[model samples]
Each structure stands twice: as structure tokens, then as C-alpha cells.
Target: MSNVTGSFQLMKSLNRSLVLNKIRSAGAVSRAAIAKETKLTPPTVTNIVNELIESNLVRESEMGTSKGGRKPVLLTINDQEFFIIGLDVGARKIRGVLTDLNAKELVADHAALYQDISADQLTERMTQMIEDLIQSAGVERTQVVGVGVGMHGIVDHEQGVARFAPTYHLKEIPIKEQLETAVKLPVFVENDAKAMALGELWFGAGRGCDNLIAVNIGVGIGAGIIFNNRLYHGHNAVAGELGHTIIDINGSPCSCGSFGCLQTVAGGDSIAERAARELASGRESLLREKIAGKDEINGEIVYECALAGDQLCIDILQETGRYLGVGMTNVINLMNPAKLIIGGGVSKAGDFILGPLQDVVSQRALTDEVKQTNISTAELQEHATVIGAVTIVLADLFTPDLLNAK
Candidate 1:
């Protein structure tokens, strides 16, 4: 009896979510349209929609164009009434966004991360940032349905624990549990890249794409993969660790203690290292005039110099692109994703980086068809990861996962 009751309840919830999402994706949809499209009977759609309307998640909007008799009433998601808190916890900074149910930004906040900070300190900073976001938005705590965290490094998404953060040298941090406790709401944690990939799928470049890879090339390089419209986490949940992919057996040492890893050669920090090395070798370029020493140098400085037509900066970026291409080529040949999206700080280099990366792909991919694989920069740019975090909560609220019944 209990099992039957559980199944019925689960199906009811799914039907409700189905009707709500149809209205959300349509921007404005009639009840008849949702029933026709979802294949749900009109009575079932009405009951579910009524529940959603009672919950303030769905509302009747303008009437649809008349077909024959009376006009049908259209429905829309209560996009602004509810809120979600999203955080992007990176190596050097913790960034956050307060977004509506539609993923529209309401408030943004950020705080720096010290190199020697402990796991506890990191959690404290993250918690403080969440509190600040809610306060800044002046929204009631109950109005926020959930909190989503996009954390870099190896994440145990199911457990909501960060297994290992290579950059932070921390392990087994229970992010979801802690945040949920602090905020008294559901909290979701995922690898930053995976979250970004889902975000792209939901609202950015990957909207209609079924199979794609969204790569984040920042202080470290990571990838988020979607296969057949679903996020694919490998057997060990480390499916998209693109940075650690060995590219050069005899290349520079990586933080992972491996020699010739892709990140050691193509990541944001790596870009700065290469530029600083060239400057150290007394290469005559604009970087020499911009900064005093290697300690003060970073990827943004290199990009600025490259924009000023500095050949050395341009070369470094191009070289980074070539190395990234080598890595991406391996990925393309293996996964055969329909599109490859480049995001993260390093991706800001634009043509100086993408041109060479595409050139390498055009030259090296397996066949003519594969070489035509579309490679593009991220649409959301700086907000990509953070928006992705918001999508975590939004997806849970709007998407109907059958497993929830299990």
C-alpha cells in the first residue's frame, strides 16, 4: 500500500513539474497547448496546473489568439516571485549570484580566497557570501527555494562533497550539508564545469544541442560534457578532468605532480608563466613596460599586452591555443560532441586564442566532417559559471526526474 501511494504521489509531482516546465519554456503557453504537447489529458493538466497556480509557480497570462470560439488563457512561470542563490567557488575568488526562478540576476557578490585558507574558512566565506546576497536582495529567506554551488576540482555531486580540490589542497568538504544547514534550504553542489555546461544547455549556446562539451580554461582547465541532453559523469565522477590529460610527456610540472599535463601548458596561470618566462629571457615586448616582475604578472596582463599588438603576448596566447587544440582534438575524436564551447578567464583572449585553436582542429581532426565541428566561445562569459549554479536549483524545481519516484 505504501509503495503504491508513493508511486502515485511521485507521478503527481512529475505531472505538475511537466506542466510547469512547458509553460516556462514556452514563455507563455495555453493549458490546451501543454496537454497537447505533453500528451497528458486535459483533466490531468488542469489539476496539476491548479496545484502550481496555488503554489504561485504558474500564473495565467494574456489570452492566446482565438482559434474558433472563446480565446484560450495562456500561462507563464512566476519568474520573479521566487529566487535562487548560486555560488561559484574558484581558486582565488568566491563569486555568487541571486537569481529569480527564470535565472535572471537580481544581486551579485564576490569575495577573495586566500591561498593558505582552510576548508572551514572557505565554507565560512561561502556562507557569508550567501547571507550577503539574501540581505542585498532584501528577499525573504522562504522566497528562495534553494542554493546552488559551482565548485572547481573533483566533486562528489551526489554526496555534495568536494572530494579533492587540487588548487586548494583540500578534500572531503561537505558543502551541501553545511550550506543547507546554514540557510535552511536545499543545497546542490557540482563541479564548476559540469554546472556551466548545464547552464549553457539551459540558457546559453547549448540550448538546442544534445551532445556538447563546455570547457572552462581558467586557473585550471576542466570540461563539462552533455551526452544526448543529459550530463555525463564518468564511472568515477571525474569525467571532464581535461586539464590533467597528459599532452606532453616531457613538459612542465603541474600542480597534480604530473609532467606535461595540458593545464601546465594552456591554463590561465600557465599563460602568465609563459609570458613571465619570455620577459625573463629579456624578450623585447610591451609586457616589459607594463609590469615590474613575474610576481606581478597574470593572464589578464598578458591579454592586455596582446590586445596592444604585442607579438610576444600574441605568440604566448596562440601557443596556449595550440596546446589546448591538441587536448580538444583528443576529446573530439573520443566523444564526437556536436559542439565545443570555450569558457573561463583564459577564453577572454577571443581570436588570439580561438583562431589558432580552430586552426589546429581544422588541420588535425580525423575527417572532413569532424574537422567541421563547431567550436565557439561561451555566451555568458564572466557570468557563465555563476548562472550555471543558478540553473542547478532551477533544474531541480522545474525538471521532472523520474528517479525522484525511486
Candidate 2:
């Protein structure tokens, strides 16, 4: 009897989720339309819609077009009733955004982090940032459904712990619990690259794309994989650590203690270091005049010099692109995704990097069809991870159990 009861409950939950998702996708839909689209009975759709209306998740809008009778009432998601907060915690900085259910940004802010800051201090700072974001957006704390955090590390989402972050030298940090205690809100945490992928999936380039990869290249490199319209976290929830994948057996040592890792050649730090080394060796270029010293040479400076037609800077980015292409070739031959998105601060180099990167992928990929994967820079640019953080809460809100609950 218990098994039967559980099964029935599950079915009801699934039905409610289906109805809600239909209405959400349609923007404004009628019960008859939802019933028809979901292939559920009219009575079931009516019950779920009423429940959603009571929960303030869905509301009756203007009348729909007539279908040979009285105009049907249209239902729409109550987007303004609640909000979400998304945080992207990087090695050098932390960014936050307040957004609606549709992932539209209402307010955004950021703060820099020194290399020596402890995890506890970082958590406290993040708590204050969340409060400031809510206040800046002019929304009451009660209006926020939850907070989501995206960090660069192996995050145990179920445990709400950051297991490892090599860049920050952090390990086993209880980020979720600490932040929740400080802010008094439900918190969800995930890997930054994975969050960027989710952001693309729902609101950016990956919208309607089931098979895609969002590769983030900044101080370090990582990828977020989407297979069959879902984020693939693997068995240990760390599937997309593409940066650690060794591309050259004789390459420079990586922070991960691995040799020939992709990040050693293609990451922002790697590019900046290579450019600085070249400048120190007296390789004449326009960068010398653009910056006061070699210490000032960074990825952004290199990109700017390259954009201004500096041959050495252009060469450096071209070589970095080749390395990135080598890594991307391996990814393509393995996953065969339909779309590949390049993200992170370094990707801002635009054609100075992508042209060479795409050329390498096209030449090295195993098959012509595999090389056909559409490659483009991230549409959201700096905002991807933060917006994706909000999706964590949105995903929970749309879950079957939550959607069906009274």
C-alpha cells in the first residue's frame, strides 16, 4: 500500500511539473492549451493550475483568444512576486546579481579579494555583499526565494561544501552553511564553470540547445558540459575539469601538480607570463610603450596590444589559441556536442584568439562533422556564472515535489 501511495504521489508531482513548465514556456497559456500540450486530462490541468495560483507561482492574466466559444483565461508565471540572488566567487574577485525568475538581472555588484584572505573572511564578505545587493535592488529580504553561489572548485553540492579550490588554496570549506547562517536564506552552491553552463542553458547561447559545452578560460581553465539538455556532474560532481586534462606530456607544470595540463598554456595567467617573458627577453613590440613595466603586463594588456596590431602580442595569443584548440579538439572528439561556447575574461580577446582557436580545431578534429560544432564566445560574458547561480534556485522552485506541494 505504501509503494502504491508513493507511486501515485510521484505521478501527481510529475503532472504538476509538466503543467507548470508548459505555462512557463508559453509565457501566457490557457488550461485547455496546457492540457493539450501536456497530453493530460483537462481536470488534471485545472487542479494543478489552481494549486499554482494558490501558491502565487501562477496567475490568471488577460483572456485568451476565443476558440469558437467564450474566451479562455490565460495563465502566466508570477515573475515579480519573488527574486533570487546569484554569486560568482573567483580567485581574484566576487560578483553578485539580483535577478527575477526569468534570469533577468535587476542589480549587480562586485568586490576584489586579496590572495591572502581566509575562507571565513570571504564568507563574511559574501554575506554582506548579498545584503547590499538586496538593498540596492530595493527589494525586501522576504521577496528573495534563495541564494546561489558559483565558486571555482570541486564543490560538493549535496554537502554544501567546497572540497578544493587550488587557486585560493581552500579546502573543505562549509560555504553554504556559513552563508546561510549569516544571511538567513536557503543557499545552493556549485562549481563556477557548471554554473556558467547552466546560465547559458536557460538564458544565453545554449537556450534550446541540448548538447553543448561552455569552456571558461581565465586565471584557470574549466568546462561545463550539458548532455541531453541536463548538466552532467558525473559520479563525483566534478566531471568538467578540462583544464587538468594533459595535452602535452612535456609541457610546463600546472598548479594541480600535473605536467602538460591545458591550463599551463592557455589560461590567462599563462598567457600573461609568456608575454612578460618575451618582453623581458627584449622582443621589441608596441606593448613596451603601452605599459610602464613588465610587471604591468597582464592578459587584458596583451589583448589590448594585440587589438592594436602588436605583432608579439598577436603571436602570443595565437599560440595560446593553438593550445586551447588542442584541448578543444579532444573535447570535440569525445563529447561531439552541437555547440561550444568560449567564456571568461580572456575570451574578450575576440577574433584575436577565436580565429586561431577555431582554425586549430578545424584542422585537428577527428571528423569533418565533428568540426562542424558551432563555436562562439559567451553571450553573457561576465554575467554568465552569476545568472547561472540564480538558476539553482529557479531549478529548485520548478522541481516536481516543490511544484506539486501545497
Which number leads on TM-score? 1
Leading candidate by lDDT? 1
**For residues 1-406, what per-residue lDDT tens digits would candidate 2 score against the true structure?**
1232223234446677688788888999988889888899999888888877876678997768775876778999989977899999987899999998798899999999988888898899899999999899998776787899999978887778999988789889899999888887778888899889888877888888989999988998889888877778788887889999998899999999889899999999999899989989999988889887555778999998888889999999999988898899999999999999999988998888898899989998998898777998888898988998887777666642321111
Candidate 1, poorest ten consecutive residues by summed lDDT: 1-10
Model 1 per-residue lDDT tens digits across residues 1-406: 1232223234456677788778888999988889899999999999888877876677887768886887778999887777889999998999999999878899999999988888888888998999899899998776787788999999888889999998889999999888777767678898999889988888898888989999999999999998877788888788999999999889889998888999999999899888878888989989887886555789999999999999999999999999989999999999999999999999999999999999999999999998989999889887889999999877776773511211
Candidates' RMSD to native:
3.8, 4.9
Superposing every Cα of model 1 onto the true structure, what RMSD results? 3.8
RMSD of 2: 4.9
Q: Write down the TM-score for model 2.
A: 0.93
Clashing pairs in 2: none
